[model samples]
Target: MYSSVDTIWTLLGAVLVFFMQAGFAMVETGFTRAKNAGNIIMKNLMDFSLGSLVYWILGFGLMFGATNGGFIGTPDFFVTGDYSSSIPSAALFIFQTVFCATAATIVSGAMAERTKFISYCIYSILLSAIIYPISGHWIWGGGWLSDLGFHDFAGSTAVHMVGGVSAFIGAKILGPRIGKYTKDGKVRAIPGHSLTLGALGVFILWFAWFGFNGGSTVSATGDDVLVSMASIFVTTNLAAAAAAVTTMIITWVRYKKPDVSMTLNGALGGLVAITAGCDAVSPVGAVLIGIISGFLLVASIEFIDKVLKVDDPVGAVGVHGVCGAAGTILTGVFAIDGGLLYGGGFSFLGVQILGVIAVIAWVAVTMTIVFSIINSTIGLRVSREEELAGLDIVEHGLESSYADFMPLISSEAATTTSTNDTNDTIPVKRVNSNPNAKMTKIVVITKQSKFERLKEALDKIGITGITVTQVLGCGMQKGNTEYYRGAPLETNLLPKVKVEIVVCKIPVSTVIDTVKKALYTGNIGDGKIFVYDVENVVKIRTGEEGYDALQDEAEAPSFA
Candidate 1:
């Protein structure tokens, strides 16, 4: 019988899951360079949009239809099926559709920044319509794994692991982004552009996960069903919290401080780990799972980046694939019933291991074939020029994702200047050089924050018309060592401002004294000033030479 309450719950779950696309998009964009932000958004958007249409037309039937030899579902194209459920078939379809999109979209982060847009679209279609559904049938659609009593309540293996394994295969085939690793095999840290957006995305995913884990019950009527839903919610929250805390501590110990990005990944890793046994594990078990996931997240990311030499910008392989597999296997040990630790023996635990291994092999082989064929034919990665220039302009014709933040240039002024009479020449007057005036050029390299005060001090000492340029350098200190994503930057370069000033009438001692007064903080990084002798000076607008170029025609020198 169709139940209104159950139908409402399922629909609500679908909507929440659908919003996760935004979360994934924000996370991927923030973790990558600003140049590739638009490309990231397009990938996340199209994967869901395209995956939705294809999942409906073909994927739904293959995942939920009658079983064929307990391996694949009989093709029920267009979603015509009589799968037993209290919710309407349409409701179940939409709910499952979002899950399919989630699995397809996870690849966007691992292969971001350098992937061809068309290639990614094709990959999304294949993953949604074929790669996901076939394995989904084995776990959820009355296939061999389900018959053997493998427990994956909310798809740690079927969804997250499937996506994670595919991500690993695709990243391995695509190769690292340019400049990710040096010829000497030294790792360079390419930090994300925005941690704020990444944090927002994490919070959004955390909020939506309640629906993700709780909605799997698909019921609101009976006491047992309501209780199970509530338990799932609690376990999910506990696991994520425990994992985040654990990661913060681990990074603090290893990296000398807590890492914001890796800690966020830890929270996500906890969520993925708990997803497999949210319903079966106790709250304590959820925390234990989360803690384990935190350790795995840091270790796996380090191993993948340093040892395996894979360039995963968002740690997708670690948080999803590694933790997802660990979570599924942990479920066998933590489940209250039929668990190895619960006196049910090794049979159930063995089944869980078999399910994880089977899914990994299935996803690995299929994704390898998919990526290989794509690489050989239409090409999987973008060209060197397109990648260096960013996919936003070359691939999508977008100048920038943050175009509004850029400075506006006036085209009318540029046109007027370009069209001016260049052939006409103005009469020039050459002024005699002042032999007593020894023109001195003072170059000041100082901390960025001291620029305003330094400028004021220079003006007071009649040392105006200074040029400032932002630069990166280090003194004898060589800068303090810092950590990015747990990797130590031993030779860190600090940012400073270089101020250039040329003086003719003003005494060099006066200008130097003023600069020292303004910049001196009695600190190691107070900055230094270099004095140089200049041969001559020429003002471009008036053709004033030597001392004439350093002073206005109508004004007297402020200093002697």
Candidate 2:
């Protein structure tokens, strides 16, 4: 009777966990470029379908079938056994299958915007059917680790760790986004499209997690069951809250401002950290674990980005891998000993470390081999042309910004860029009121000292007015590199300032002359100047004519 009650509640929980695929899809697409939204959604759909179907065929039995002396289950391929009709059998397969698929989806976000659709599909199936199940068998399948009393009450190690590590490896193979790391080695902040969508997806995931941790208990009645569920809920919530605060505060202190995306990742870091021992840990323990996990996540992300030179676009490694390992280890410390709260010592802590090492080895080695095979045999990346054009139009032949392109918005991005280009081409609608149409205007990218010489050259050409902006970027000259985590992040370029000069239509050639003279400090990468045709201009403050408005700004921007 007790087993029957537990089984029913768990199956219900599986259903909730199953629905979380939608949340993952929305979050991944929202966080990446709109051009790749369709592709992202497609990968997610396939991951679950492929992961579950594969798991059902042979993965499930290996994970939880009758075991050989508690090291691993055997003879349960396709779930062929006398226990097939048992309640625990079906409930176990359903719950574990969801977790396997969830792990596979984590990679989708980290390697998004660049990975080939075929590669993603192939990896997704491998992760669920092969990667997730093998590790799951070790810990939860009554494998050797289970015999050693290794505990992962929820799947911090089995699901999150396996997924996170795979993501980290995959990201390394895929390389950074086209302009993410500049040629000079400076890391640039590439903001996601919508913060609102990212945040909303996080909230939905939080709601679904209750089912994930609660259903693991497999019971509706019993004091122990209730205690575990309530404890896990508290721990989960605390960890998420801790992570958000920790990231916000760290970023505020380091950058003098809170970074929203870091905070979002922080929340997830907290969740992954507590999953291993949520049921066993005390509420106070949860807070401490959560706080540490939150801080670890921020550090880990920076490390991975700067030091490891791994471009995890969405930071799945910090939120899942590091936090997962930390949580699983913490479980041994807190639950085994007095948990620092009940006076628990470091004995369990040692056990936790051992478990983490084993799991890491299993995942790292297997995934490396599998992915390397795919990389060597079939290319893993798409052509650079396809990436720059946006995956939607190139791959799917659909534009994500259909509305902006079709209906049109007066002040929208595309329109603004188009208007600027058109105005440049139709330049010289009328001669400058001042008869000096020969003044050459050059937009020079250089320093203040170097700029003055260009001004002198412009003076010779009768060029007038210049714009200077203090900016930082790379331009083929090697820039200073900063380390994030243990990776060497290299942009491999140099930084320079840009100077703009405007002259009469005739003197445009002179402006170029002045810039070339003033610039060129005999350095590898001093700067460059380019001229473009002028177009109609407008002054917001007053209805001013052409030259006056043109004088305000002279350079045409190459919109990225």
Candidate 3:
């Protein structure tokens, strides 16, 4: 029997892999429009939630049960009846279920922003219940591929390749997202919403990947298992780091700037590439594989985007599908025991190529039929109107992911006045107004990164009446050509923050100085501040005019 320690280790690994669902969601959402964030989150959640149930009902049985004709498994449906007790059945099930879910979630990003939610859910179920498991069985479940000496230590082919290939097919069938291409077949760049969130997701995925490749050992017993686990951890991290550095250097040389989105995806590409041979390759070999994966990711993304004209918002196909297959082949070249470099001949390399080709054929054909069926029925993509407006409101009735960008202001101002009469009697009244205040509107156009600091400066100067809007414009640069997946995108408009502040009592010169100090970044995109003379202002609630309109109650509200 496998030791209890093995079971616990596998279970912990399952938990780590399961947590990757959140990472995938964030990465997908961050790489797409804020309008579709809720939809992305929903898809990630349901793929696991519904996928686990479906996999339990049929997928696990079809994958891990007794082999039938070396094609699929038979029996063990619903995980019932008498089964082998050699290992922990529950642990295996959980680990495999997460893998299946990972494959299902990958396609979501490629087809995001334009797919119908219902159509996506249907495809997700099909991928989990049939598509992924069947291919997975071929390699990992004692099927024909396993008999042919096909090796994928951690599912570079079984999971990443399958999902990536399926994503390519789905994206092709769904067609490019609206505004992705022009009348002359020129591909346009649709930038992601948040690099910070995308970077965070990449980091989380890096953390989870330790479990992904390490836990594939499925045991923590004996010194062999312990040693193999440690090796997997080091190799996995080395490949990812190598790929990140390589991608950064490549982007710097090619684009004259380090592209954050591509760099993050490069890290993932390295992880995927190393997944196939982390157990077999040396640290140097792993680094070599990672460097190749980085270059391959950049090249493949460019080819798929520019040559094939496929609109994959997050470069999912390049990162997963192309890199997955390459990584599997690299295993044959890097494996110490049977590697071609080790004088093991071309046998392992040939088998690796054969397995990759066979699996790709199976997944591509199966997914084509599945997607075709769905396309003819409820449809695969959303309407153009819905796509443009965003899926969050159309599908889930939620606000944009950037809902927090809108600020809420609450402040009060009290005015006091005195009147002198001819009879030497003076009457005083407490009024809410700012009669003598001079109001000026300061419009600061600066980089989004400087907004917070500018706001802090304004607050420090007792000027808090501010409104901010995200606007797109260009200055001397006139925007630049941004290459996405190698396609040149002429972006004439650049993103900037427009901060509108109305100061009644605060010095206009102070506000100007504060904004200038906060936003002077000595760069081309440091932004500009425009000061305007305000003729008048009025408060809606109180019949106050001028500066009074911008003021609020001086004291806090009391419930009593």
Q: Identify the candidate with maximal TM-score.
A: 1
RMSD of each: 4.2, 9.8, 6.6
* Candidate 3 residue-wise lDDT, 126-187, digit = tens: 99998888888889889999999999999999999999999999999999998888998888
Instruction: Return the clash pairs for model 1, or none.
Output: none
538 in model 1: Cα distance from truth in Å? 11
Q: Once superposed on the true structure, which residue ranges of model 3 sit more than 4 Å away at CA?
A: 81-86, 401-444, 449-470, 475-477, 480-490, 499-534, 537-560
Candidate 1 deviant stretches above 4 angstroms: 410-413, 416-478, 490-495, 498-526, 530-560
Error of 1 at 400 (Å): 2.4
Q: Estimate the TM-score of every prediction.
A: 0.86, 0.72, 0.85
- Return the candidate ranking by TM-score, descending: 1, 3, 2
lDDT of 2 at 37: 76
Evaluated at residue 324, the lDDT of candidate 3 is 98
lDDT of each: 0.90, 0.74, 0.87
What does candidate 1 score on TM? 0.86
**Candidate 2: tens digits of C-alpha lDDT, residues 1-560:** 23666777888889878877877777777677767778787788989988888888877876777777765566466765644332556677787788888899998899888877788888888877767876788788778777776788888998899889999888887789887776776676555556776787788788888888877776778787687678778878987787789878987777666777778778878888888898888777778788888789889988888777788877888888999999998887667344544566665666678888988988888888877877777767788999887776766667674445455446677455655445433333444454333333456676545656766776665555557776666666554443322233354433456776544443455456556666666875567777765444444444444555444443422110
